[model samples]
Target: MNEPEAGAAPEEASTGAASAPSGLSRRGLLGLAIGGGVAGLAVGAGAGLTGGVAIGRARAAEDAHSAYEFFGAHQAGITTPVQDHLHFASFDMMPRTDREDLISLLQDWSYAASRMVQGLEVSATGAVGGPAEAPPDDTGEALGLPAAGLTLTFGFGPGLFENEDGDRYGIAAQRPAGLERLPAFLGDDLDPQTSHGDLCIQACADDPQVAVHAIRNLSRIAFGRARLRWSQLGFGKTSRTTAAQATPRNLFGFKDGTANILADDTEALADHVWVSSNDEPAWLAGGSYLVARKIAMLIETWDRVRLSEQDNIIGRDKGEGAPLSGGDEFTAPVFDSTAIDANSHVSLAHPDQNDGIRILRRGYNYVDGNNALGRLDAGLFFLSYQRDPAQFISLQRRLSTDLMNEYIRHVGSGIWAVPAGAEPGSFVGEALFA
Candidate 1:
């Protein structure tokens, strides 16, 4: 899609921004009126949240801009309401890139992200004509469009710190012990190129174009500082982060996130999600660890599985999504070994079996067309947030022998330290540098 160009104007002239839901705000139009001006009104959520949620301003027209706040105690995307689309990118620093360059790029990214989330261009000059020799600041495809409730969450991978030789960015001392390389597990087929990066950006929005535009502009801004390693475009979010949003289905047709951690669950968030101040690194007090896995689903094989077998493997009703042993969808599972398969997917991965450990999952379904083998290339792009990496590791270990593994393959994976959100003048991950 063409990026928003500065000269482009909206199709209709509308005034006044419609208020969004609590913890979400309505963003007004971005047209000829403010073509080259910075959005003095930065993006923000209506209700103050631990992790920010960008609320989009409802335009006078049908469902135009829904803005989510970008500044808060924690980054927005992790615990925010799940958007319809995801454009996740991992980046590697240039061989010669140093600490100072990394810091500069981060600052630039923060400013640009803050502006874009408000439905403004990356800079005051944006895509409009500037010095004839210089390219437009923003690509411009998103011009004249509302923010679409965009949220960009940033994270630093384990590689960002000490390398084989030693600390590369001179901040290895600050690396949290909880942030480390994820160990390989059973039935793993991780691709080296797609598995790891020094940094990552997760941009999500109700509009695909808006999400894509954010990543494109950020990559442009990074220029020689950091280059994209791998990115996946995901559609159909498989989880819910707020009570107001319904649980979404994954590509496998299962209702996912039925047991997810909602934003309103302050107790759960503190216990299982947010990193506490006493965790040694005072800078990471409100932060969380992000785990990403690119899972490949064998749709053909799954389609061939009998409905009874499918339900047996999943331990849930195919249509109603209720536990095989249960009453309603959200009713606590009985974990009855006689009624459900002992090796069922849910049975093994349930918190009951994993020392009562749970992770806040924010997964999305992905379809990347067909692979070389002429099979459908698609699966759940699993994303989860947790206070400690041990939670995820324990769950995966319990699922090593899950009946569902026959139809799914774990292909790519990475773990990153998602630091606390920035104040107005600060950039994401600025604490480490300080």
Candidate 2:
């Protein structure tokens, strides 16, 4: 649910071997062992090197298409054009863990995430080059897959700062004043199991397996330090961060995010999305706040409504996604026009009505099979990044009166202070630890 510039030195799988271990990179060895035949067993010897060269060759080709740098001013996924799929996960630090445990966890995650984004495996040993007796550092699912425009964004939840036991990581004072659990909203039937966590990672990629692989391996890397609380898989991106991409649809079959803040809009981004240096908590400068809402759509009930009524509820023509007041999809809505309902979704969430507030949205549609009543348990996984949590709080409160409220329920919720991106050799959130 973010944006990042595309550029990473594609780590090519090596085609030759017989080099000193100190001189060769992990990928180089993996490339030689898997790309070339026998006699090139510099590492992981007798660990089965007959897997074939297709995977190595595939990695090279995939890198050429999508490989975003993991280090920047802000995390990539937020401004990086929203990918086709999402694998969002939340985690909790294990009890009895000290500050070092937390720091090391972030370090491990950053190291693995940086490599994965470059179309490389989680470690030098990777899936096939590890010792025969030990588990490989990376899961094999994504070995042959390209980066697929994958971007992994990490965030620290309120619990990470201070939980019931108090200041577990000794950084409670650094928590932003607005970083607490989101207050209950109207029509909220949130489930605690999926509501909050101590940490969260948003992995996005065009390929579902690649996205899943990232979370899977990162979770494995956590081991005793932290445990995953909950996760969600999503597809059919509900919003666009770049104008080059088309606005995608939610499960409700209407165009979404027609007027979302674009990555190139630096002025708007600074004003609405990224946290500033002058803001509180100097450690979080250049970072942003992420609010995740797992909204459940009443699919069966909405389907029974007449087509025109559906348009009225959303305040946009389902066909062209234009405001009912006229003009194309991108045209400003004429809220004064009688054609637009005062309580319509568009009218209530419009920036003009909300004191000029705007948020960068990166949402996705999810269908998690049928519920007990034989209805599709599908809806929108709403993800938005704003400079302040109050921005979302205000908007959600205003939406309580929207016409679309009858068709959706907020089922899962979480808020995390997404720190600025890591520098080339540093882990994400390093400033916070410092």
Candidate 3:
């Protein structure tokens, strides 16, 4: 659920006329390394998102492998068990590429994604078989590793439908009314370099290597059609989507998402998370909207605050994670209690305070080294999904005065209209192309 923004480049499909010989098997899996094993690439500037750690030819993407199906009514990651790691890449499409190029890229991307999610190589020819002197078809780093429950999701930003230059992909007419650019919010300190993207791919898996491998291969297949804009690697989920999973803590060390919407709540999903065919543009039937915010935490300052004040700002107990007014973690907070501050996080973000509106939060904890001042450069990479973008917008507007704002700043933001999953015979954005 955590993410970054990016653009792309691609590798041509293999001819299938060639197959790897014995001894070349696992080395072929190393073919999956991000940036195709290149260094100081993929993300730009401050992020330095390059580290193509090669997984030697001795390993294969098969050892403890377990896979999730690629074809479904809705994408898998949205409701799937929250994964351990996320490799999010955002991309800006190539200039004047036209609709055909976009379509072809989607076709190719879907093919590669479908195969990779199933623990198969991206190309029919695998990594070792290709033009002898040219680059290998597959990168090979993911070789010998289990599939690790990997899921890949695709999304289109407002720019993808119509950029400043007009509808470059000839997709302006099909843009859903709900896909507008997000409005600037209070306390926003967004960095343009890591902010929005024309498109995005979110890869999640239990294994970090498997997650990075997914994004790397897809970015490789996207060459010529797109370029990387920004990317983010996130760990330690800050939210839970199921009852079986224990509630996890954020950097603030509070049990987060204790009252979140569970994945199995079909009623709640239909009412708030998924978009139905009757909604708009018609093409987004089973899809949803994704909002990403890179919130930077002022941890040093937060740590300096008294423990009781910290709990007061959060509206929950430091150890129990219970609402300040009483009860257990999942117990409803007594919002009306005199002990509860009106501006506290839970008080302001509560569904009751927002007209029963709620968004599915899938945030992750991130630590990107240290800032120039040498303090922790980290915060919550906030990710949420809702049927209507306004649902999130309205709720956020209500939280504009939250007491937690003193310790966090929104440094990155993006909103993407997640297209529904590809059916067996189609690509991810097939409906839009139609």
Candidate 4:
């Protein structure tokens, strides 16, 4: 996708004498008046502001052709120990009158899924690494969504569809190594490339049965609302498993989301993830951004490596997100000699060099059991959010051939442009194309 021109405006004059109210020029004002008058006529005809807003929003929504939502979880403190868990879900939709219905279905599914997992001690955080800013309220409760014990994230693609294909969305769920996969209704014949929508859900509980039960129940609710096009099921190490025995740390068994920017730190958050837009409609000014990627991992092949090699490839210890160069989880990674050793971090391995690839990654590690060859079915439901996808793509492409590439694949991908929240009585996407 072509990078959008930076929305930055020219600097304003400093002196009072030079400063003047930059009102619309005569022609511009005339245009506004004419447009408003026409809009008034539409309103007078009973079309209402909703229609006007929807029309405007439709113009804007045209930019968000592809999108995705990602969710994941981990254990908190010393809670349950037998299983580690995570989950992901994604959907792609065609932009039509049905778009609203699809969004409603997802909203309902999210609400229902949260209810099913209520009381489970799972960790979740949304939009871990992406350019998009954090929602005004981190709790997500205002949107009628639950606060994940670990993390939950939403990303928007550059456009809803490619050449009139359709809008697309993605989901990632993390759970224990043996948790059940999403049902056939959600995963049957899913196409990584052409499939327009995707959804994933996963959970972990003390009992494998409980995890399966929660997942199956949530699947029914989601599938009941929207037709499933394609899907996959897998398992991975959970926070509950002993650190030494957990396989595929972060599901890729290498430090995942290593470059994820911190959300709580004001300066860092503003620089790495959030987008500020004074020109944007009032409803969207403080809102964050979103970026979604449908990344596929080659887990069966990755599992063949020795533990030490895996650590080198991922630049972190498999058991924890610690830097291979040494540090605790969440500590700033030291990209020094050891980390950049030709045999280790390699020139292409350092994430900082990959400009335009900036985001907060909040995703799930999944495993789908061994295949006929007995190889483990493992990969990442990779979801990332950023103020823009253009920036994130630069980083992802570098990783395409990085040592990690041998263990991962990018079979499917798309982009979406998400807008900020809507006012009361207004539906999402009403701002640009009512």
Alpha-carbon local distance difference test for all models:
0.73, 0.77, 0.74, 0.35
Tens-place lDDT per residue, model 1, 213-273, is 8887777777666778888777678887777777677777878767777777777788788
Worst 10 residues of 4 by lDDT: 1-10
- In model 1, the runs with Cα more than 4 Å from the true position are 1-63
lDDT of 2 by residue, 97-131 (tens): 88988887787778777888877887777888878
Please provide, for model 3 over 127-153, each residue's C-alpha lDDT reduced to its tens digit, 9 standing for 90 to 100.
776666766767777777666767888
Pick by TM-score: 1 or 2, better one? 2
Model 4 spans with C-alpha error above 4 angstroms: 1-87, 92-226, 231-248, 278-304, 317-339, 342-351, 355-357, 421-427
Count of clashes in candidate 1? 21
Model 1 gets an lDDT of: 0.73
lDDT of 4: 0.35
**Alpha-carbon TM-score of each model against the true structure:** 0.86, 0.87, 0.87, 0.50
Instruction: For residue 277, give model 1's deviation from the true position in Å.
Output: 0.7
Better of 2 and 4 by TM-score: 2
When sorted by lDDT, best at the front, the candidate numbers are: 2, 3, 1, 4
Cα misplacement distance, residue 35 of candidate 2 (Å): 28
Tell me the spans in candidate 2 whose CA falls farther than 4 Å from its real position: 1-64
| Candidate 2: Cα lDDT at 214 | 84
Could you tell which candidate, 1 or 4, scores higher by TM-score? 1
